[model samples]
Target: MLIKTFSYTSLFLSFLLVMTGCKDEDYALPVPKSELQNDAIKRTLGPNLVGLDIEFAYAMAILPEKGKIVSAQVEASIAGATGTYLEHRSYYTNGSGEDVGVEVAAPSTTTGATSSVTFNRDTSAATLRYFYRIPEEARGKTVSFTFSAKSSNGESVSYAMGPYTITNMDMKLDMVATDAAACYISIEDMAIYTAAEAAANPGKIDLVYLHRTPTGLTFNHALVSPAADPQYLPGVTLPAGVNRSTKVNKVWNLRDFHLARLQYGVYIDDVDFQELNLEGAPNFAINVRAEAGVWAETADGRYRAYIYVNKVNNGAKNATISMKRYTMP
Candidate 1:
């Protein structure tokens, strides 16, 4: 009986030891030294196209006791276009979810591939935005950025951003095409030409825009190739040398935001143009409505284009259009 009692006592002690070992313990994080720090993020989405802004937010911070920000700069791998700039203002979100900006530095200055902004206010932390307008030289190429910040206490920090690729497709927006005037479109030049202009560059004319109200038919806004059938080109005469047999196919409900600038979030990238198959497609698109579009290919098969109808003015017999063109190899 004494032996059994001793065994029970030993088991009770082992249970107590196990409970003590499972007790929670206090912990603390290691403190880091105060220093200048910077981070960057790309804010723009979709294909980085030429003539559009590639936006980034550069955030820099230092402990209040450390020092004030001296200056900030961004160096692009390839020089941006003339309009590229770094905003000197810092933005913060307000209660209404709107971004409110405050001036924390003087206006920025750009030289070559570098843009710099110097702080004028007493600020230890700020988030600045940089807008790099993709240049013609950067087309079909990759570009990167180095964002840096310097503090008054002789400390500096830099953050590197992506080598983003620029799309080869070209975009032109808000072009007006009036019936029988400025109606000829050239995908090579990406512009609308009048009858005289089309006559001068007849070979470049690919598509013709017209608004006709023919009897027994509903052809309000139409995009007809220069070589389309006579029935589709009612009351119209083709300019001399404008006889390319271009191909066109109509599409509905494709409101690409980049082209239509509408509420829809759809986008057309390079692959869309590459994968587009226009074999056996029609040469004319009739009764085109706002937000509607067409897929077109030049006669020589050198360029493929997407023409988007932004708006149509039936009373004025005109339409606002935009285009995205891709050059085929």
Candidate 2:
């Protein structure tokens, strides 16, 4: 009977208050989703060069309870020399860093656009890998990637990774020279042996020397250890026209790997010779025969080289060695 006299608005307001009081409230609201910190994110570029299959891996942590990561994207911007820039095609990957199996549209190659792209993504963590063919325009230019991740709860996060620079040094092989008396021959110098210099003398043979000619590559594999005494011309020569396919099961003894017939008890296998290619260098295939990749470190280890043997001319007593030098960041 008393309810009959109550106003409809008043009754509705009282009912709303009662309903609100019936349910429990959460004092702590969910925090906003967070992107991985810069320090926590790991970025790696595998052999950066133009017109080559270069791999990029970004590993990050995704905090638990931040909602499952649903999707990830990358925006790449290439910087031009004149202070201008061009936008590359966006690449998408799963959380594991693998490429999704869809074709992505790429711009013209002359504009620093890569043709082939692949990557992988981790479903749990924020790990991603991108395998791309480096474009010619990207050489000597800096390219940056901005990554974004979205969550199931409609929350999105982003991280900026690198302004990784592509260099011509990798493609343009340099010729260098070091004294034959030097104890160690660094690949950092990007040295190639010339026909003019030969470490045949006693003092000259006591140290390590590298000679790279168009026909062959010569180095002292005998004195590899610091403590080991420099033996008589304990060097190995990789002759031109020797490739993995043609020179299989071949044994490289003193005659095959050395300039003269000097032996220091070191032997090399044909299988040990590995071949490498400069991403976009056409001359890579020219006159290069038996080649392999060798890494030589500096004394302080601040500098290093990823070297490739381009040619070996044993008759001419010279070898051609090409390299890409890197400094510790």
Candidate 3:
């Protein structure tokens, strides 16, 4: 198989060289540092309620698949950020040309990043996000995102991207993660770290952990670069023909999941630590929590999945739970 290596200096040169063999595959000009992610607030058609003067709503283009929506949160390269970005999210609706302005708070202080932005909307579509405003000075800079999403089923999707720019943030790329299924994202609190804090904390940028459920059925929930790999890169590979340049955005691993729910809520219970004894992986515990279960799916379906939280630990601390998800098959 042929290969290509991209870099800031060689980006231009590589582009020109690759263009020679380019096959007119559709691709987005890369999201400036951060790509648009889905907000976690769900929309429901009220059985009997007021829908008038409904200026408190907005529709997200990311329509998640049927019976999805569990513990959905957005992630990106947000390390060493100056100020906090949106963590928890909500939405509002308005007629065309009407802007729904909102004020938000950061995530609650906890092991994992989050915001106390609990979005409870009673509308068709609600906009859940920590809408960013690239100040005049901050514009034209670089950024990226580390996102997380889940369906009622145990299946989950997480990704990382960018070093994108602030200028020219307009985007239109179909390599979008969410397909016919509408995506649910909880863009919660961000830890806008200081240079001192980031420097003091080495590997903070590279450190990653996975969220688990109350039941200890899932193992290796935290994502790793590779099995038995000293350095785990949480990206996937695809056929070259499918995308001009295939990007390993997210890797969804389905383990031994045999629960009885179609569309359930998500909660964290314990953080299953990984065994860092892999030659060079430093000895450390992953950060995670379990949660309460919600809307689950039937016993049979396509999107069904089992979890794989890190069981590579010394059996010292019990994993923590936070959010739980009811899945469908």
Q: Who wins the TM-score comparison? A: 1
lDDT of 1 by residue, 86-180 (tens): 99999989999999899999999999999999999999999999999999999999999999999999999999998999999999999999998
Q: Give each model a TM-score.
A: 0.89, 0.33, 0.23
* Full-model lDDT, candidate 3: 0.28
Instruction: Give one clash count per candidate, in the order shown.
Output: 0, 34, 115
Q: Is candidate 2 or candidate 3 better by lDDT?
A: 2
In candidate 1, which residue pairs get closer than 3 Å at backbone N, Cα or C atoms, i.e. clash? none
Candidate order (lDDT): 1, 2, 3
For all candidates in order, the CA lDDT equals: 0.94, 0.39, 0.28
The residue ranges of model 2 lying beyond 4 angstroms of the native Cα positions read 1-47, 60-64, 79-124, 170-329
- Model 1: what TM-score? 0.89
The 10 consecutive residues of candidate 3 with the worst lDDT sum are: 46-55
lDDT tens digits, residues 1-329, model 2?
55765777688899999999899866898874364422114233333556544444444344655545455554567522221221122335789997554322232222232222222222335445444455667866777766555655566566675667665433325232232332333333434333233232221111133333422443322213222322323343322321111101111222222212133333222112222222232111112233443443334434434444445544544444444555543
Give the poorly placed runs of model 3, Cα more than 4 Å off: 1-68, 78-82, 87-89, 101-126, 131-141, 158-161, 165-329
TM-score between candidate 3 and the true structure:
0.23
